[model samples]
Target chain A: MATIAVIDYGMGNLRSVGKALEHVDARSRILVTDDPATIRRADRVVLPGVGAIRECMAQLRRLELDAVIREVGSNKPFLGVCLGMQALLTTSEENGGMEALGMFPGEVRHFTACFAEAGVPTPGKVPHMGWNQVRQTRAHPLWRGIPDGSWFYFVHSYFVPLLDDAWTAGMTTYGLEFTAVIARENIIATQFHPEKSQTAGLALLANFTRWDGTA
Target chain B: MTLAKRIVPCLDVDQGRVVKGVKFVDIRDAGNPVEIAQRYDRAGADEITFLDITASSDGRETLVQVVEAVASEVFMPLTVGGGIRTPADIRRMLNAGADKVGINTAAIDNPDFVHQAAQRFGSQCIVVAIDAKRVSGADEPSRWEVFTHGGRRPTGIDAVSWAQRMAASGAGEILLTSMDRDGTREGFDISLTRAVSDAVPVPVIASGGVGCLQHLVEGVVGGGADAVLAASIFHFGEHTIAEAKAYMAAQGVVVRLAEDP
Candidate 1:
């Protein structure tokens, strides 16, 4: 049985993440924990978060889960959601510039100027809440059952932009084209909430359970 | 493709049972909260909001239980509204598996409570629900005032500015409900929705008074809401969320369909 540890470092909607995992694959052991030992013992790791990037990073650091995330994110079949995805980046522009885990080479940016810069007639919403189509840029194990352009639920103000195509697994356009899914070998992270995304999301989670941490 | 506008079905819950009330009165039992939520989830509801209309303090406890039961069964985002006053209330609902908690009366009473909740729980989970009534007549320029206690207590605060203030104070989304249109099934007040949606940087959910699917479309197309929320139409089986999304998609408004290719 695959024991997947969902890192619970005081982020938003951790329960929903755990419940979604159970719903997707009943046999797999889903652990919602803050302890580093249990996380290391688990076969796979899922880092889920919602809210401000600064607070997310702060909570991770305070709980010493940052080091655990850095360790497992590189070796295990790792999945990051929303703020957890942002935390993998080197830096974030939110809360006046904060340092991230540097798991990936990028910076999290806000969505205010992107609308005008993208030449959109009306300035898009800041949080970028609701369902948006995620275009698969490259094939990965995570994209197994989901179609190429499937809608996923998103709720965030900041997103990682200007990513290298090598690391970007998926691309989604809001006011401007932003990297929604970033993957590097074993690590896969999404800007959208897979737990809240219904059919496609459930498929993604099911894939994560069986994945062998390969590209 | 662009971000699809969301369709949310709201359940007015009173004491664990899903109830349908017209203008917060003439209540009738709709069904079980979990069962209806499951139906909406299968029908491709972008989100679900449970507004607790229970008057007694003891009955209010059932809201958390309902949220817990629904969250366990349903996969979509769930929001719990009604009587969310303190940070503890917000924490309780979120712990109960609600993705977000809607703040209506408490926010009207104290705007800083929104900020405090946002600061503690993160703005993404804090949905500030505004109940607005048209204070201006047909002849007068359109103006809306904020109302509390389920649209009965008028605060005289301008709805647009209040929405702006709430967003500025760290509200991630605004649930804009038109008291004038709420139970009347007249449709969302486009002017009110537009005013609030344009004023605030956060995403606005145009809610209340949805008689048909076209009203859902107008909430996004005409009103510029990021999401549209309706209760009775969805609750009473007048229309499913799938039907609403299809109509919106046909009307050139971007919406996510259940079987989208």
Candidate 2:
């Protein structure tokens, strides 16, 4: 039985994320402790988050899980959800001058100014809440069995600007095209909350659990 | 790019159990909310709305346990409505794990409540549930008038303008239900739905008058609703989630099909 450890960084939807994993018959534990030993020993890790990017990074630093996350992402299956996924980037435009985990080469920027410049209405919104469809960029193990143009729940105003085409697993349109999901080797992350994405979300989690860590 | 249509299942909860009957009477069949919520979750439901039908009569405390149970058990987004009168009620619902809080009568009495809740919880967390009935008078222009207290009293507020006002006042979403069409299993009021959808930039969920899968599709494609919220058809097992999504897919409506459960 694969033992999945859901990193509890004192933020994000903890209970619902755990229930989503359990729904797929996976043994899961919500670990808030920054103890490296427990994370290193787990078969899989889920970094779930919600709120500002700077705040999330600060919490990760406070718990000292930053180094642990880097170590685990190199060799094991790691999943980052919402802000947890955003933290994998280099930096963010939120909260004025805060660095990300620097796992991926990109910056998290706000959707307000960009949407306004494009002449889109309803810009500068704090939370982009509702259901939106994800356009799969290329075939990947994480999106296996999930159909093309599947709608997933989203609630965020800031999104990741991908370094290149290689890092993006899926893209969703909300006023404009935004990176919905990304993947690199053993590390996979989604800007949308898969836990709140219904069946497609559970299928994604199931796929992550069965992944052999081979990209 | 066209917006994707949403499929929503509404659960009318009376004392923590999902109860349904014609015209919202006589608790025909009852099942645990957690059980029904899990079923909807598996069915690829875009969102779930829990109308606490007994909250006002039974008090807010009883509904808290129901919301907590469903929120803890179900993973998808949850919206709780019925008897949510004040900012405190909205706060309690959100604290109980409800992603969105729906307001009806209280919002009608004091339109400021919508703005107040929106200011406090953010517009995304505030949903205005409008229950309207088509007026019969020739001078009325076939408009929808807002109904209050479980659709018992008429507020004479035009549903169309009210929808626009709600959006302007900071409502993230509008759950519009036609009282005449509800429980009738006839079909949704396409014109009414289109009117509201056009009036608001925010997403509009069409509720009431869903008889079959085709009705659900029409609710999305023709009615211009961002999502279709159904009750009796889904609760009575008339059509499973797989069937609905398959029907939707065939009709060119983008829907998340059910996976192997």
TM-score for each of the candidates: 0.97, 0.77
How displaced is residue A30 in candidate 2, in Å? 2.2
Q: In candidate 1, what are the lDDT values of residues A51-166, reduced to their tens digit?
A: 77778888889999999999998789999999889999999888999999998876788888566666777668878888899999999999997899999988888888959999
Itemize residue pairs with steric clashes in candidate 1. Answer: none
Q: What is the interface RMSD of candidate 2, in Å?
A: 4.4
lDDT, candidate 2, residue B261? 21
A1-215 in candidate 2: lDDT tens per residue?
Answer: 55778887755446677767776753555454456788888888889876556667777888889999999989899999988888988888877857888899878877766687678764422356666778888889988899887767887767876457788888877676778888888988998888887767878988987887776
In candidate 2 chain A, what residue range of length 10 has the lowest lDDT sum?
A122-131
> Candidate 1: which stretches are off by over 4 Å?
A116-120
CA lDDT of B75 in candidate 2? Answer: 72
lDDT of 1 by residue, B1-261 (tens): 888888888898988998888887899899999899999999999999998988888888888888988988888889998899998898889988999999998887787999999988888899999999999988999999998877878898999999999999999999999988898898999999999988988899998888988888888888999999888988888887878888888899888887795
List lDDT for all candidates, in order: 0.89, 0.79
